[model samples]
Target: MTGAAIGGGLVVAWWFLPREYPNPLTPARGEHVLGAWLKIAEDGVVSVAVPQLEMGQGITTLIPQIVAEELGADWRQIAVEPAAAAPAYPNTPLAKRWISLWDPATAGLSGGVDDMLAERFATSNAFTATADGTSLAAYEQPAREAAAAARAMLAMEAADRWNASWEECEVYAGLVRLGDRRASFGELAAGAAGQSPPDPPPLRPELADETPQAGSSEADAGPAASFPRIDLPSKVDGSYRFAGDVRLPGMVFAAIRHGPNNGSELTGFNVERAQGIGGIVGAVKTKRWLAVAATTWWSAERALRAMEPQFKTQYPVSSEDIGARLDTLLTAGDSFKTHETGFGEEAMARVDMARRYEVDPFHAAPVETASAAARLSDGRLELWIATQAPEQTRAAAAKAVGLGIEDVALYPMAAGGSFDARLENDHAIEVAHIAKELGRPVHLTWSRREEMIRSRPYAPVYTLVGAQLAGEGEAEGGGAIDALKIRAATPPSTHEFGRRLFGNLTPWAAIRETTGMKDELAMEGMVPPYALPSVTVRHVPVETGYPSGRVRGNAYVAGTFAIESFVDEVAAQSGREPLSYRMSMLGSDVRLAACLQRAASLAEWDGGLDQSGQGLACLRIGDKETGGRIACVATARQGEGGLRVSRLTAAVDIGRIINLDIARQQIEGGLLFGLGIALGSPLAVRGGLPASFEYADLNLPKLGDCPEIVVDFLPRTDGTAAAGFDPGELGVGVVSPAIANALFSATGLRLRRLPLLSGGL
Candidate 1:
């Protein structure tokens, strides 16, 4: 419960004088947590403050979508606000201990990748670290600990008043009861008002630091009793007073021109010439850029454009050029600690067959996208932006403008879609610095050209697979191909997962590498989907030049493509259908078989998989309930020009479903994101920059692009299902490979490259 609290005080900017209204990304430190406030306002009009901002992923609708299911309030009345970042970090329970782990560096506060590590907090196992305090053991530690603590405090308070042993007390819902006495929490809320919440928190015997003692209270009571669910109506109706919808009296809109490109600094500029322009309030030059302040967005833009900029690009590396450079970085670098599984060297020596595959993912038209809107009130800079990491933006802006952290207010609005791009605060920080310097609210949206020039993209990974088949099989070209090995600059990642939860990467060995099952490098075709008793997989890590951030199922996509393709080959080798081959390795998970059966029925896989060439992919995100998580099957199809996803049929058995609908939406959304990367969104390099400009040119799946999806949830019939992926963790991140493999089955063409826009489908 103890961590470094962001100190000092909030600077209240009073001047509401006309200016561009702020976007929600500019975090406003709220008094209560978003979930807390949303739950408290749950009477009739539940106002849910979403912790995650909505740039376009529809978090505004998504969070409320989940909350409305629980709150049972009218969805029409729901209102949302971007939750403030004052709780130090967003209210993620990924690693409850992430905040409580007591780091000596920041004194129990979170570290740089708090957002990444936070994923683990949602688990349920205890004992904190692995038995030896190394890896995380379980999930929902924060929720679990908080719930247990609240229960303990309630029991203790009841025990003290009833003059009875705390051991005799049991807390249910929001009530404390003993033998013949029962009291609702509302009644005790008043009496317990002044009482201090327990230090180190309360606990239950199960989450206990020590064995339970007779007649005593444990420290980990369930906080589920204290923090209630949010009930805010979603902004589905579009009536919410969003920053874009906010208008104030005498407001003046403005726009600014920073040094060419982003991160370019101004040599210097004269504002006197700008003063001559009509309605020109002022021209401010900050450390890195220049901004034009005027009465209207047009006035500022016109004046700014007219005032020819005099700056030079010091490091003129455009986005397109950066992209090509990324390839050179790959396949040639000292492997930092990416991940390692079994004995890599031993596994490599066993390889007798090898083939190289190049994945030239052209992520076109890179753009430094930002969601920011703000105004200067009195003298303070108040802003809102659509950002993945709010803290990163504030720090950057504050540092740029030389303003005290208190002066820069940020509200993390709903982000559009995070491809690790939103996490870059440079765009927002530059805008804020410009606005503050001009003494005007500046709204800066990147030009299509600029957007493509400044970005980090997924790696253009090149992988080499070496296979050593037990028996000598004639190669398609008359060469013997077996004793396999996979060496690549980029290892297969399950959704660019690098966090402690199911996202992080670990090395895999020959026994673990069934490279063909999903991605030759990632699963090393060693996925349990096959019945291979003896196999080996190895890795050779390389780096990429373009800034690579978390892309949806980053590793899963490439890895699965290689793995499942290999699986198809194995099936072809055995003269068995791919589905039959997959059915063989599924003894470990009969539920997986059930899901496969259902998906097969839905997609009619049993009828004619070979003829129709439908392929499936399933990955396991190991956990406590199901022992291991298996992304049952990501189903896909092939069409004339492009791969038409018939449906990403999924069969998952994650235990709890907080919001049945959102879970489906999240999995579906993630699935589409990965597909978008495959179909038409690979960022490319043209003359040292990304070629695709805006989404218009990028060609992501539109409303029409979405497939006919069938989500299958395996019943915990034996009370043996997982509690994570609530709604369900289908892990559709790597499902594209299955789709690709299926398409290859249908078309007989191997497109290792992404976006079949070249008319190659």
Candidate 2:
């Protein structure tokens, strides 16, 4: 049988099975349960359940806005509840997208968004991971459906009391009214709970959207955000609670130190020295790590420093060794084809132009380090932490303490910032072991140095791009491409990450499992968006001793840096304007072309003339019809201090806008993040650890260093009900190339590597 047929059979069998799931959101005494997603309070407050983490992404408000917009509730009365992990809230879209990671054997069986197999697997496992910008895609419809159902029920109750037909009643602004008679949702909350909703709930005709008025000033833009962020007040007043804020009656602080490299064994530590420290509780030693617990975190950290733990590794990872491996692989190693179109390799027999680009590994460097609080009592473990994959964290904690999965209670907490760093559960496992050993509550936190040593960085990549001209006798300056080929030498980072995340294997074990596997995700965004006759993208997986995993922007950051930099070089060689050269190739990508045009206009295009100090780049995230598009223009100069970026102008088309304020915030933040990558240190590794641990050493752009950024969203002309794409990572991938191109214009020199000055000008 075909894979789809097997998936269909499983779906049929699953429907007949008894699947009873407890509601994660329990209503308070005065609140009535509307649906799994929300509850209506007697005081007219609507509490919406949000399954995704609020790591400064405004999801806490975004999800609630979707619910309130659909239910016609007042924005001021809407509240947010961090939902617990349950089968009721599964990120189906993410599950489908990551089918190959979780179940490699049956990955090909169901990878579609609507596949029942993906839904069943996600629901059964309660896989509510928050990554890849899939929150809006996965939870929007479910939230809307639940809100719609509650709206109908409320209207029915109010209609019965008024002796009018429920179909004739209108619900708006928290009120259910029939002509003049009306009742607040709060007043009908008890009766609505007993009322049966329509078989198919009455849904609003349009999705939530807003269009920014043309020529609007910064002051005018403030009013466009109809529903302000719910967490803003508490965040400003220092009342917002994160995982690190968790406290228990008998809780003690713990500090841990892990081996520098994976597979390293902890030799020993100065137990006598650690015990002599004041306020020291005790120390727990494991094969791979040592943890010191004390009355306060400072004492615990001090104890660890005094103990001086020693580790032994078979081979320590170093930047020299990694660079040597990439250099050798890029020239002669075997390659596996990951993506192809049209003629594939048949048309790439002869290359007209070729360029090589190298990108060093990048650290996520989230403000918050790994932290988790664990308490074990009577074979039950309660964990408080911010994790992208809550179920995985819970399972890891349970296994560490030798307890059943059900014997764990996980309290979801907001993260300070993850950037995919929180996906790893080592801290969760460590806290569980410490709590179990100590027989008391233990809050474990890794120091900055320890975080840099233990956390995985983005894989370094070496890429060689070749292009063929359109005609046989065409000059190099023709600026027309016939074929393109890309060969990237890097570890199978995503595949390795999948093994660690889904298979629950150690980093070294995961690397062993996916040694020579082909990873398309590692080569994502390699194919050019322009019209090309033939293209071939290849991945050469090279092991570098050290493990690398997911970071914000994933492979796109590296891919775009290579492709866009090469494109800009091509434009310079062809004696054509950068913007026009790109525009000519965009045959059917009208959205991206529009973005480029608008961005240029916004920045007052100067045609990228010599010493103009302006550069342009554009990118598309998904597909042509339903994807996020972005174009960025950067203004930079070679100042006395160094490369100084004065301004950045961006035009984005994420289909229909959901919340204009949040969208702009994401784009602006992503741009600055990309700027950091463009100019910050390469985070070179030495002796199996990062060379620098302090944030100050990274040379990141501070408030005074930040450039002026202007972001504008294209109004949706297709319709009002268009699907909105996630704008979180779009700006991140496009800014580096734009900045690179800008520097080239200013200096008349081409820097063909990430961190443009890594090798020195």
Give the top-scoring candidate (TM-score): 2
lDDT of each: 0.47, 0.87
The sequence of per-residue lDDT tens digits that candidate 1 reaches over residues 384-454 is: 77665555466567666676766778765554345445645556666776666555566665545445544
lDDT score of residue 731 within candidate 1: 50
RMSD value for candidate 1 = 11.7
User: Which candidate ranks first by lDDT, i.e. highest?
Assistant: 2
Encode model 2's per-residue lDDT on 1-761: one tens digit a residue: 22344667976665546587887878899999988999999999999999898999899999999999899898988998899788999998898878878777777763353366678878999999999989998998899999999999998898889888888988888899888797998999999988988878888996777655545433133233388899999999999999899999999999988887568889988878766678887789999999989999999999999889999985688999999999999979999999898787898778879999988888888989989899999889999999999998899889999999999999999998988999898899999999999999999988988888888988999999999875332254386777899999999999899888887898989888888888888887787788778889999999998989988888888889888998898888777789988998888888899889999999998999989999998888887788889999999999888889999999998876678888899999899988888998888877787888787887778999999999988876665465488898998889889999999899998887888788877
Worst ten in a row by lDDT for model 1: 127-136
Error of 1 at 324 (Å): 7.3
Local error of candidate 2 at residue 449 (angstroms): 0.9
